[model samples]
Target: MEVYVELTYCMNGILFIMTYEMISLLLNINWSFLKILFLSFLSNISIVLIYIDYLPYISFLYWIVLFLFIFKKQFFLYFPVFLIVYFSILFFINTLIKESFIYNGILITPINYKDIVIVVMTCVFLIIETIYLIYAKRKIKPKDDLYDVTLIFNNKIYHLSGFLDSGNHANYLGYPLIFIKKSKIDTYQQLDTLIIDGLKKRKIDIILVDQVLVNKQSLRNVYIGVLDELDYDCLLNKELMGGII
Candidate 1:
């Protein structure tokens, strides 16, 4: 019984890791493998509830809460994919590969052909997702100067793809300026307006966000310049590579 419980825990951990990776790929979220492994470890801890009298009920609820906490508003998107992959695996094992047995939502069979099903399914999904990710990245990110940026403002997080441009030397009183689409930050009500001289003088909305991450490097209290039109979601300042201007 103890060995069966341990096997179930191990299997559940692997499933959780693969499921999380699938969702990340589908959403194009850049999460490190170590982060996924850590989350999976935390999620596997919920399997301990299986030993209780309530069995799967409380255990499942605990899992949902963990998912909600981790994914936040994105939980809705993640949950459906999780359900589909999880149930599909179970269905395939139960109907097609009936060599092993599942007792009380736990795989009790010794390591055998049943384990291969999980590996094969994981490989298939990962390969498809990898191909899609490669194609999408190539389509969206045509240049090597593109970067992944994260911004925190108004207590919200925004992920954006940024293009590096050396010509963007715009600065305000020694602070570097990065341009983003107006639609992205226009919804915020508390932005300070600024006038800058260009081909013609124009007013632009500016806000000092809580933080900005350019290629994962932290820039605290960074000023974001909102523009009416931009080809990329963000225009990265060349000076940002060195430090704040």
Candidate 2:
């Protein structure tokens, strides 16, 4: 079977870049796509050189040099860790593709399907790696501004996703205000209209809540109020900000 050299090179370039991104995610090192792509493109040159020389173990040497040059600040041990993840997936996928062909009584030697095999294998592994990374992120504590919370008001329990509002420093005579979406609670005007008016006029409220639970911490006597428009189900009060931030 005749192999298309240029097509193979381009395919390898793309696959290498995708594999690099997966490795970077696994290592918890954030790298921009363009930076990884540029580095991967440069790395593919080693593949061309290896292909020309038909050399074994040359790819490893080239990657070591590239990692050292580009990631001088990172721990050197992570280079081999990344390579192990990248090549293990690549090898498993390529092996499975070859086995599929053989099991079907297809003669691999007579077929010019190497490029197709490489692309398909890379895509499969990339998808698997990405899904795993997403799952891991969900299991880990989120690093964003929002967090899950439980609120107890008038002996009734409610679960909510709370967004931290640094601008919402509104307190009711020293009681922190936790703003809930108006539509979420069935009862309207739970607190006196005078308190609502006081809130709008002076950023103070007469309404108070039993408890607020967030990030394993419980807060007492927080003011619960409702807003017509809010991005989250609940807005965490500034007084209780110490628990999360």
Candidate 3:
């Protein structure tokens, strides 16, 4: 007599939403936000790989703290988030790969969940890739002329690029715009209403980026400086953005 049972109804199941918890998971991380997440995810996997014999939960905690130390600033709110994210990853992994090795259906090894592991691993890889993107963005090549450049907004971060013609380096004597390109700007409501006002005042289309996208500089409220000349209907082309007047 043989009994077939599908344990898909267990606490850890195949259906999972990855992005649903991302922002809610990591709260108030500072310095390099994506960088810390990348390092954290990598260190988590590395600990598992090297210490093959250790329990995943225990090893994950060590990696998380190890990363938190490298990232400066303190956000007390992030602690609960850390636990939720860790367990969420663990549960997802446990449900998927828990019974692959122990064939025959009789021994459901909860520890051997592979689906959850694969998903978690992929998420970690994405975080790590983000670090490379952020770092690569910061580096300036010799070819890049610092004087005149168009600010290219992508991935919620600004990449200062293009060339500034020496003859055209006259700084516009007004608040510089925090331009949010059409491709970049997702939700309009996220931006403060002031930018829209600035757009009207400057006789340019209102372009406002999300507050979270910008790093803290001297600017109190990130203002919108719509270039009066550039066609607000489209992103200011590199040629036009490099100069003022």
Clashing pairs in 2: none
lDDT of 3 at 165: 36
Best candidate (score: TM-score): 1
Write candidate 2's Cα lDDT for 81-111 as tens digits. Answer: 7667656645554565553221111112222
Order of the predicted models by TM-score, top scorer first: 1, 2, 3
List model 1 lDDT by residue over 66-110, tens digit each. 878886766777767877765565455445434555544434434
What would the TM-scores of all predictions be?
0.51, 0.44, 0.29
In model 1, the Cα lDDT at residue 180 comes to 89
lDDT of all predictions: 0.70, 0.63, 0.37
Write candidate 3's Cα lDDT for 82-183 as tens digits: 456645655555455544332111122343346446646655755565555445535523244432222322334434322333343222224344333344
lDDT of 3 at 237: 24
TM-score of 1: 0.51
